[model samples]
Target: MNRARALWERVPAPVVDIVLVTVAAMDLWPMLWDDTRLGVALAALGCAALAFRRRFPLGVFLLTLPVALTQPFAIAPLVALFTLAARSRNRPLLAVCVALAAVTSSVPWPLASFSEVGRAMTLIDFVYSLATAVAPVLCGQLLQAHRDLARRLAEVEEAREHERMLHAQAVLARERAQLAREMHDVVSHQVSLIAVQAGAMQVATKDPNAKEAARTIRSLSVTTLDELRTMVTLLRASGGHATELTPQPTLADLHKLVESSGTQAQLSGELPPTVGTPAQRALYRTVQEALTNVRKHAPGATGCVELWQDGDHVGVTVTNSPPTRPSLALPGSQHGLVGLRERADILHGTLEAGPTTEGGYQVRLRIPLSTD
Candidate 1:
């Protein structure tokens, strides 16, 4: 069916016109022999006018009507009426074309000298002509409706494909951000501990403190590997087990985080025990990233990490002194500050980081506990 429709659509307008005109001439040929030769010639010419029916339907109808009156036996007028009804947009014109076809086709019947069989044959001819005239009009309407429906379906499918592409892009972006957060949390925590313990060992080489610092570094490295392994295993798990993968680290681990940084951080706030896990996790990450920056950028700089809760909100701040050596060049990760800002924004929090007037760097974060 689709192949037939495609072939029909591809037919040239001029070729369609030639085919229709040929058919109309053949249908009129037998009837023209019964009429006057001049009348027959004019009727054939009128039928030929139907070659332009699709482009000028009403004009064909008008031209064919006069020729049918001169030789009512001519069948070309009926074909022209059908063309007009099928292709013309004018309703009044289609009504006129249908009435003219029925009246002209019936006129020859009453004037004929006929026996019972002849009369029946004339009636049958009139009926067949009327049917042919109406059928093409109806078929043309149905074809047009089908074309409209197909166009709408194509549009809907295209829109669905575009929406799918956009959804896939959004999912990829979220996964990338999550992976970045995980890497920052793991690497920054471990590297900060290494730097702090190494600095302590450098100052305590002759004292008993060097052994404890060495042990701390070893433990820190081992713990970092275990956590990384757990993360990889969780990623490899499937389906339902994925949700039951690894537990997320939260603010409860903040104390251990500070101790591992090898910085003496004093806690001085009454934190709510019932804070949301995500909020707690974000807060912990904010402090972790800040302290990591300090250890990398300001060696031998003492610092304090503080967290406080007040009626549905949490605040965190980390501050550290300037580097001792003025010419010291700090190690840097360009993404650290950008990632911290993004994390705070996701949690609907605010973050500020900069050098302080007291020759130190400070990072402060504030997050609302409730979405309200």
Candidate 2:
């Protein structure tokens, strides 16, 4: 069946029409001896009309109706009616074809034959002719409807699959961005501390203070390495469980971050005990980033960090005096401030960073404690 349909599809319309007309001409061979020359010529014209049925179905239909009226024995009109029904998408054209077939089938029978042969043969012939003409028209309508329905269903399925792909890509992009933010927050402060402690050890090499600084650097490096390994393991796991990653640091760790800044620093305000893990971590990282920027950009400057909690939000401010003498350069990219801003925005929070009025630079971060 598949091979036959492929072959039919490849055949041109003009060739198919010629073949159909030739078949119709052959079907009339048995009737030739019973009819006159004019009748045979008319029947031949009806068969020739079939060749144009697909191109101009209504025109072919009108032409075949007259031939069927003149010679009821010819089957060309019935074939032309079927072609008309199949090729034309217009409903009115289909109705016209069916009506012409029915009228042509009924008009040929005589009123006097109502009594002869008990009228059964005439009635049966009328019924058979009508059925034969209408059957192909009905089949063509059904085939066209089926093809239209299948095409619509295929379009709907393709649209749904495209939407699913887009949604999957969006989810993957969000997960990747969140992972990058986590790595930045976890690793940046530890690296800054290592750099600071190493610098102190280099400056005080002969003193006992240099030994303490070296030991602190060693301890921080080892802890940072352990945390990095744990993070890698969590990334490899199937589900992203927050507990599997590093524990979120809170206000308790702010003092260590400040100490690592290696400057005289003052801290104020009693941080709220009720802050949840997310808010606490965000606040901790904000202060850490601020102080790291201060240590690198404003060396040997006094700094102050303050924290305050209201009913449903916490505010943090880190300020440091301008450098007395600017150092050569910093060893890290200056994206800590931008990362802090993005973190605040992710939590639907706000951050402000600029030079303060007191000859210093200040970073202020505010985070909502409640879930969105």
Candidate 3:
């Protein structure tokens, strides 16, 4: 049924109008052939008027009334009535049209001949014509209802799809909230202990090399704690309105971050002050992650952190030379660079990390300078 309706709808409006006009004209021709010239002209006008039924249904129906008066069962009148009923919502107007059509078709033409017909027979004919007139109106109303139901169903489906998307986001937010709790309770506590122990050792150690190792461990531990706190706060905010996290690192903190990275890294170059806070944070993180990787995977390697601007873009690049000593195997989630890449993407930027030809590793990030 739906496929048939789709096929019917595919027929062009002009073609459909032409077909209706043709059918109406053919139906009226035989009946009006022997009638007066006025009758023939009315028939022609009624059929021609059907061509505009969709645009002016009421006018077409009124014009066809004369044809209905001459020929009680004319096709033009019925088609015009159907078009009006299908398109119009004015119930009172439609009722009046229906009654007018029934009356016009019931009363015999040439009023002087009415006395020759029996009153009872005329009354019966009117009742029958009235009922017949209702069929087209009823069919047209049914079509109008069917179109309304289809539109309502489409709206319901769209609402359901939107609800599903919202539900998925809620589920993700809840998971993030749970993860935030775990990080705050377990990971932060452990890192705090590591930092405290390293601090005590740095003060108490007598060996110069051991003292330096303790200081490095403490510096790395404190940095990790700061980053973990920020992550946990962001995750906690995901379940609802964003809560502002204070003292977020920006470009001003880049030099300090590189210095405390526990690596022999040099910071160079600068970006314009117009860079946005979010972009500054991204740049700071990129350098932080790159230097951390160097300290972990390239022992005895010196690093350089360079900040620069290229046309409308500003970025930072962290490069480390080949490790002088063999590196120990380290356990990691291996998602650091992947997370950085995702952050860059969110800022409409890109992150590229790979080994250099001189056996060094380099991580570079470029993002549009945000004036906001």
Per-model TM against the reference:
0.49, 0.48, 0.74
Native-referenced Cα lDDT, model 2:
0.74
TM-score of 1: 0.49
Please provide, for model 1 over 27-124, each residue's C-alpha lDDT reduced to its tens digit, 9 standing for 90 to 100: 77766677777777677778789887777777887778757656545556765666665565676766556666755655453354445436677677
List model 3 lDDT by residue over 10-96, tens digit each: 999999999998998888877876899998998889999999999999999999999998885788899999999899888899889
C-alpha positional error of residue 127 in candidate 2 after TM-score superposition, expressed in Å: 5.2
Give the root-mean-square deviation of each candidate in angstroms.
Answer: 14.1, 15.1, 4.7
Backbone collisions counted per model:
0, 0, 0
C-alpha lDDT score of every prediction, in listed order: 0.70, 0.74, 0.90
For 13-122, candidate 2 gives per-residue lDDT tens digits of 88888888888888887767777777678677778888878787778777777556555566787777777776668877676677667666655533454466455665
Model 1 Cα displacement at 353 (Å)?
0.4
Residue 173, candidate 3: alpha-carbon lDDT:
89
Q: Give lDDT for model 3.
A: 0.90
Best by lDDT: 3
Against the true structure, candidate 2 reaches a TM-score of: 0.48
